[model samples]
Target: MRNVTDRIFQGAISVFIRKGLQATTQEVAKEAGVAEVTLYRRYSTKENLFITVIKNVLEKKFDSHVLEIAKENETEVFLMNIIEDRLEILSKNYDLVKMLLSESLRGNLANEINLPDIIFSSLKKGLEYHFELKNQTVDIDFCARQLGGIFLSYVVLPNAQPFNKLTLQEKKDIARKHAKAVLATI
Candidate 1:
């Protein structure tokens, strides 16, 4: 059952990335090697399936990492982990991210699946958790916006060297630099 659902999600992602919100359930069913009825039976509608797939993807690819990193003792380490993990995930899923962003901008997706909002919320929650653990208070909203801005900038702006193409060490270096600056601010 889980395997079948995974296949459907993967198929949905592939089709959605290629065709954005215009893709059909029939296409997704074909891609997943499942009958069209299977998709409808499970998700009921294309919009529901899209929302499920995207939420699952974001939780798996981004949110879980943030939650885990929020447990770090040091703010700098937490910032570094969040920055590095998010940049890598966002860079690797660049196409899907861009498609979602475009659809979001066009008002085609639900607010629950809005990529930027989710990212910002996840970052904000992670920061709040970290600070609460330390019994420290800071401008969590401002810090989340700053971090979210950095992530979104990478999505829409061109970089000299694409993040995915950079070596692990290079990625770490970038994360460290950004972490230091963010730490200084908050």
Candidate 2:
């Protein structure tokens, strides 16, 4: 059962990134090597499956790690770690990010599935928790927005080499630089 769900999620991700919201359940099912009826029975509709797949991806890829890092590190170290980790993940999943962003810009995705909102909110939550634990008071909303902007700029802006293609030192340098700038500002 878990294997089938994993296959379906993987297939949904591929097809959704390729076709955006226009992707059909049949294509997803075919990509997953499952019957169309199976997908329909499980998801009820393409939108349901899309939302589920996206939430699963975000939860699995982004949220948990950010919270964990927040709990375990100081402010600067947390910022650098989150930035580097997110850059690598976003770079590797560039196509999916682009697709989701494009769809979002076109007002095709639901409010709950708004990718930018979700990312920034997750960052805000992490920052808030970290600051609270340390009894440090900062403009958490601004910080979260700044961090989100940094992440989105890397994803949307043109670069000579993608984040995933950069050497380890280069990645760390980039993260360090951005983290310092953010700290300096706030």
Candidate 3:
């Protein structure tokens, strides 16, 4: 059951990224190597399938892979790790993130899914806790949102001017600058 679900999820992510919400269930079924009726049986609606992809696959991947931070890590180290992880994931999953952002902006998904809120809440919580541990009195939520904006800028304007042409080292430098920007608020 899990294997079937995973394949469906994998198929959905790829198809959605390639075709947006306009992607057909038949396409997803073919991508998953399952019948169209199986998709309907499992997901019920296109929106349901999209929400599942975001929640189960995209959000899960971000939490486990990108947002995992050690309690024992130093604050600066934590910041760098997070920024690096975010940038790497965003760079690698550029098309998917772009598609999700478009879906979010166009309000295509059902309102209840709220992908942005689901993805960012963890970052906000982590930042809030990290600040407390460091005895920092910064506005935790604002800082978290600001960092999110930094990531969003890259996603939205990846090909904007010199930013698009930055080498990997330059990208890391930008991440470092973002870390410093957050710390400067303290």
Q: How many residue pairs clash (N, CA or C atoms closer than 3 angstroms) in each of the candidate models, in the order given?
A: 0, 0, 0
- The residue pairs in collision within model 3 are none
List the lowest-lDDT window of 10 residues for candidate 3: 64-73
Evaluate all candidate structures by whole-model CA lDDT and list the values in order. 0.89, 0.88, 0.75
Task: Give candidate 2 misplaced runs (Cα > 4 Å).
Answer: none
Per-residue lDDT, model 1, residue 129, is 92
What lDDT score goes with residue 124 in model 2? 83
Itemize residue pairs with steric clashes in candidate 2.
Answer: none
Pairs in steric clash, model 1: none
User: Among these predicted structures, which one has the highest lDDT?
Assistant: 1
For the record, the alpha-carbon RMSD of candidate 2 to the native fold, in angstroms, is 1.6
Q: For model 1, where is the 10-residue window of minimal lDDT?
A: 59-68
- Which numbered prediction scores highest in TM-score against the true structure? 2
Task: List the candidates' TM-scores in order.
Answer: 0.92, 0.94, 0.84
TM-score of 3: 0.84
- Please give the distance, in angstroms, between residue 6's alpha carbon in candidate 3 and its true position after superposition: 1.8
